[model samples]
Target chain A: MPDLLSPALIMIVAAMAIGPAKGHLRTAVLLLAPLITLWAIWQVPDGVQGTVKFLSYNVEPVEGSALRRLFATVFALMVFVGGLYAFRLARWYELAAAYAYAAGAIGVCFAGDLIVLFLYWELMALFSTVVVWCGGTPAARAAGIRYAIMHLLGGVVLKVGIEGVLISTGSIEIRPLLATDFSTWMILCGILINAAAPPVSAWLADAYPEASPTGSVFLSAFTTKTAVLVLILLFPGEPVLIGVGLFMVVYGIVYALLENDIRRILAYSIVNQVGFMVCAVGIGTELALNGAAAHAFAHIIYKALLFMSAGVVIYRTGKTRCTELGGLYRTMPVTTICCIIGALAISSFPLTSGFTTKSLISLAAANEQMVWVYMTLTAASAGVFLHAGIKFPWFVFFQRDSGMRPKDAPWNMAAAMIIFAALCILLGVAPQWLYPFLPYPIEYEAYTAGKVVFYLQLLLFSGLAFFILLPLMKRTETISLDVDWLWRRAAPWLLQQGSRGLQPLLVFSASTWQSLEALSKRMAVNYLGQPETADSEERGLFARSWPIGATALWIAILLSAYVFIYYTD
Target chain B: MSDSDSQDFLSRPQTIRRLWWGFSIVLALTVAAQLVIYVKGYFVVDGWFGFGAVYGFLSCLLMVLAAKALGYFLKKPADFYQQDEDDA
Candidate 1:
């Protein structure tokens, strides 16, 4: 064993302790585990720290780099904050599952080989399903099953690719590879599925909102962001990601615009935000990679803050629809303010974390002179402000009053939101703190005069458009269908239709067989002997009785004829 | 929690009107700031005066309308999936 313990182990062990421990002891484990993990994360020096023999291969379970540390830092931070939010209210099992899920994500951050990465990846899939199921509703159970299926499918595809890579390249070390071969392409597809890329992206919007309020907050932080991290590590510069990323950006905006559920809106926006990172990774320059890494970091905080606020609403009012929520700003001031800050940060407004990190991606695109991608991404930026930045706060907090006044979040939840909300602004204002931790050296400024002015014009006008078209964007108690409809609705309907279509053929075949049997029986009755009685009329040839002496005489005559013919031949 | 007493100031009609006017002015100033400050842009067209405002507004308009149009096909009742679960 290496001198430095794996940070993932600490969280997993804490997760184990959480279920049986009670009161302050459980709380102590919940709060201290992540802090201890954070300390352990920093303790590991750069490069591969240790290896263990597994089967025939020496697997690297711990690697240290700026990128790895950055991701692990956020994962640990998320666990700590998420624990603080949930410890008081969340069920013991939910808290346990959430910690385990966080441990899986942290494990992936330090994984030094494909095999190690895969084990952690699956650990995440298994436990996140448990988190989703913690919602404890039939809906949650069903959604958890669907969520499990999609991620497990992704894991299988990833395993197949890793196995193929190991066979062809004779190595399992996690390194950059292009989608130029079957194995690499499979790897890219697998990662994209986890990233919630299109056609298969609906599982995220379907599942996250259905989890328990606090569970959703934990659910929101880990899975897709881990997918983004691995993409940064394994498949940077894969050109297909640009198109996939752009689609996600636009898809999120459109669907979120049409959605009525508050958390579902945020869930779609997760896809949209990850789209930015995925696109940045595709750009593949040092600046682009930094943008992707920094954006992931900033995104996790603000997105979690947003979820935390929404979770508070769901926790207080048991209502998830936009139509059922309004005028909350008066009563739940802290949550409203924190949510707005998160919204602004997501919109990449002038002095928020989103602005600082997301602009780096657009800057990367511009540096490459990819005019179309730059333009489209610039437009998508405005779209984000419309769907998430204004729409979320407006519908839930500021629109026509629902005449219900729920109290503010409980102290711990409020503290969690305030902490992340503060981080959103802090990182935005002082990106120098974040930039140094990026994988590459920094050579960019986030708040140049031109950039700030340009972004302000873009976002503010989009805000204008939002209010101007408020009627069109009204909540309608509806959900927009996505590709998951294939399994959720279309595939099942197809099976039903198929069975309906096959019914007549099956009947026809059965009738035909019955008639053939009758015909054969009639032929036997006519050609061969049968009992000539009314009771035996329906009997088939094999069922009929014949006179024994006549039958023996006929057999003997036939045998003699056969013997004569054989002798003549 | 009283409906009349707890009505938020921002929701009052007068405050709303004032907010609308204030917001409009800020929007105008962002575009007008281009006169004094030369806002460098990577793309040629993006550099044009009020381009960000115009493009941003237009893109949002297009997206909202596009979503509304898509809603006709894609939008289903809140229990869309739940209905299937019930059948099963």
Candidate 2:
């Protein structure tokens, strides 16, 4: 039997009501729905709660497990905090779309079948495109179109894979599949596309920054992390993922290092951070799975905190490029402090959420004796500090005074930052709160003196490198090419050239057809032995009148030819 | 303390110098912690003295240099994609 009130349904219904609800009533629903959803999420006991047969397949809409509960809980909390941050700023439709997007994420957390999961997945794709368009700029519109196309393509790939699996196995159940056949490999490809794996990874950096400030905060929290959650559920211990994850880790850091836009830097680092979770899922140990899940949870908080701080800067200063911003700490002290805290958390400094969660993956690698993966993750940790941790706050808030004294984040925005900031520390201090929610038993401790010292040394040295290399890392108004170049520049250019190249062929074909029609008209006029009338010329080739006797003669001649050919065959 | 004085304090040269000194001390101390803490290394190279520090520094340097080299080929004006829109 289906539960009467699932957590995702509350938000979905609230999203539907937002268009009609007005003023204070809208605000109340926006704030209260997530709180209510959180309450509903907790009330759900651990099992399949909502199941129904659809199209001759049993579909379970709500499957309660610790992992699902953990993801849903955070997604609900994200909606509340993100709503609070955006309440005073965003247009009503943006808020509605964001709530619907959050609902889709929540739905994915509890989905028990491929059909139900694909439904939620498409729902997210639709609403998120609206949120991107809500930026109300030309760039946002173009980026939103590209974002939609990429996701729709991804959905088609995923749908094809799901159909393949259903046909092959005669079931719609979502289960871990070895990448042993075409169907499973297709399934893995579909999920990794959302994980921002390379070759298609440019979409995240392309679209997220074009979103309005508040839209980015919601955008940052859900999509890729949802992809990570699904990966942990479905494709654990796939060895090839280790190489893919490593490439993403290095790719993100390099692009972030070259980035000039403040949010784009953070966006690239999101790929970097998700790289850690992907690598962990690749490791596929019990500890590794726990690490991937825990890291996704921790990453959502800190990354949103980073984006919130960036949003405040953009909202106030009307600038986003790092070259155009600096010396913000003097006036915007609260934002600076909060941004620094977020930086520390992302860098995995001791006593922050990242310190508690990210180490689990590294330890899993070490335990498995995957020496190369372990060392690469260690270096990427420092590189994270270089690009995101120190570089973001240093360039945006503390470098040479840009002499702009914008006000700090307004009260609601500050409250959102403060709440996530507090969680960053609280999770670090008391990881026990988060540990029990893992898919496996917690057999690791995070706060060892030796590990702390090692990370401190690594991160601090990377910081030293940042200052030492600061001259080379100066902000510039330049964009770096990614695989998007094929579509953005090359594909359009190729199409234009292709059309230009075909012009002569088209002209020749048209003229030749015109000549053929003229010849046929002359033949008809001569053979029929009737004077050509004005109407005959006007009627064109196919519509020109011919005598019945002449047509019968032509048909008899064609029949004679056909009879001869048949006899020859 | 007055508002101007607080401003004077942060903007002062001494503040910069003091920050550098503190930075150096912290770096030294982090290096010193290698003696006090025993890190279990999964690989032979990772176990060497100050492996993480040297590796982090060198990798960061290489990354910055690589980005600089890549910028030669990949970097374009911010309005690069805007060209597509204008043509369309």
Candidate 3:
């Protein structure tokens, strides 16, 4: 009811409260904050509801739309569920940082202007880095720093673009723009970096798997999905995104296939899954936009579910590498079933949320008659089944027995995963509930007999291929090099090499400076007739005293020369 | 527990064999179902009978092989980055 009451404020305030609250009080704030935020999100009416004067511009902090509300609602839901999963086990600081991170994401959803959006974008970056650091390992500390650097670089580029747009158009209101000029292109690049688009996507796989399991569930949901939300809001129908999205699709599969870390594989598939949404946003039809939005919502749920399951395994067993894990399904039945559901959803298997939501994007491509894009997407869908759908669960849960029995997820974690797993099936079976909330009116149906048959053949055969290629898919304790290698390895190596190569030059320069100093001393001694032995303690020519008369005479000559030259010129 | 006692039903050799047969049958059924339901494809090649099955299988094969090949070049010891940490 109050003006300027953004739901982001509620979560942030609760985050502050959580830092000091203890035990039951902390639990109460963690659970209640998101519920209240969800209510506040829905309470906002359509269009811009709040604005304030800042500098010469009117800063709109709260705007409500069907799309914005959809994203915000899901974010709020994620906070509650993620909090429920983590509160019992996670450190209080992690909960606080995760809450603030969720607040930033929700803030981006309702940001009415680019300025507010950028601020929230940064808030997400700052707090998500904290969540990453909560891994409490040296690797986590390093990865968090890298993640921070990458996001901050992206934020600067985005800020520059926002400033450019403001100067050019005199308006900061969120609106669609093509990447036709410098500013829009900068904005696209900025968003793509967060979207984990190629050439810089390694950050997702690099930082995420390193975070604490509970921390990762929060990480998985916010930053990249917020990028998708902004892409939907700002740069729909950009042709370049098609190519960028396709690259991400194939890249995710290949890298994930090569990965052995359980969580890293899931992290790579996050890029892969987001690739579907990015491609949908590129397609930019009402249907494609709806697909992107719906896929993001479904992706956040299922992806978090996948991370939650992986987190439980990591929590129970200290090992993280696939080479070190198997037969988990025997002891951790609940985690296994939940992981399978998450995997099925990601694969777009029939009667799953992925099928209901992802089909819309392929349908949109087909409708537009983009045959190559359609084929690529269809194949990528199958690839998703191979790399994430079957590969993740097989290696982590059902393969050769590792002969170790670890306890399943604790009660709260189980409850969290079950809630998301149910949502996956619910949305799959009854997408009609999700359809009305999409930004566009719905005309497509997901459960056609033909579609079901087609998708089943596609995904199931991919399953067959996975089993057939089981020998080739053997896990190794290794990581694939990505673009981050340029910064992480190559750049540092180059700098080391450069310094090595410059060793002679540095020595030569030092000797040359020494000679110059000696030469100056010799010249002063020979010309001025000063005793070098007397000035030996002085060490340099400037350190010796000179006669005032000689100095004055030299100054008079230099002044005369300057006057002569000036007059002649 | 002994090996026999510890082995779960799902991991037993006989059950594994049965699972393979059952999985094969289900895969065949999915392709077979396409005969009764006419699948309209946006592209000419996709319209071919069992296109989804064949394409999906081949795509995954290519991706697996590609990843394996890439692993030769891209794969590094798990502690590769950690070695950098040591150096630092």
Model 2, A1-569: lDDT tens digits are: 44734579999999998889998999899999999999989888887766687888888887788888899989999999999999999999999999999999999888888998999989999999999999899999999999999989888888898999999999888777778888788778888888899889999999999999999999998889889888887888998788888899999999999899899999999999999999999999999999999999999999999999999999999999998998889889999999999999999999999999999999899999988898899889999999999999999998877878899999999999999999999998999899998989996788877777778889998999999898898888988898899998899889999989999998999999999999986877666543556445455455567899999999999999999999999
CAPRI grade of model 2: medium
> Please, what is the TM-score per model?
0.90, 0.91, 0.91
Query: Candidate 3 - CAPRI tier?
Result: medium
Off by over 4 Å in 2: A512-569, B1-8
CA-based DockQ, model 3: 0.74
TM-score of chain B taken alone, candidate 3: 0.89
**i-RMSD values for every candidate model:** 1.1, 1.7, 1.0
Worst 10 residues of 2 chain A by lDDT: A528-537
Lowest-lDDT window of 10 residues in candidate 1 chain A? A528-537
* Deviation (Å) of A408 in candidate 2: 0.8
Q: Name the candidate, 1 or 2, with the larger TM-score value.
A: 2
TM-score of chain A of each: 0.89, 0.91, 0.90
Among all candidates shown, the one with the greatest DockQ? 3
> Residue A392 in model 2: shift from native, Å?
0.5
Q: Score the docking of each candidate (DockQ).
A: 0.68, 0.61, 0.74
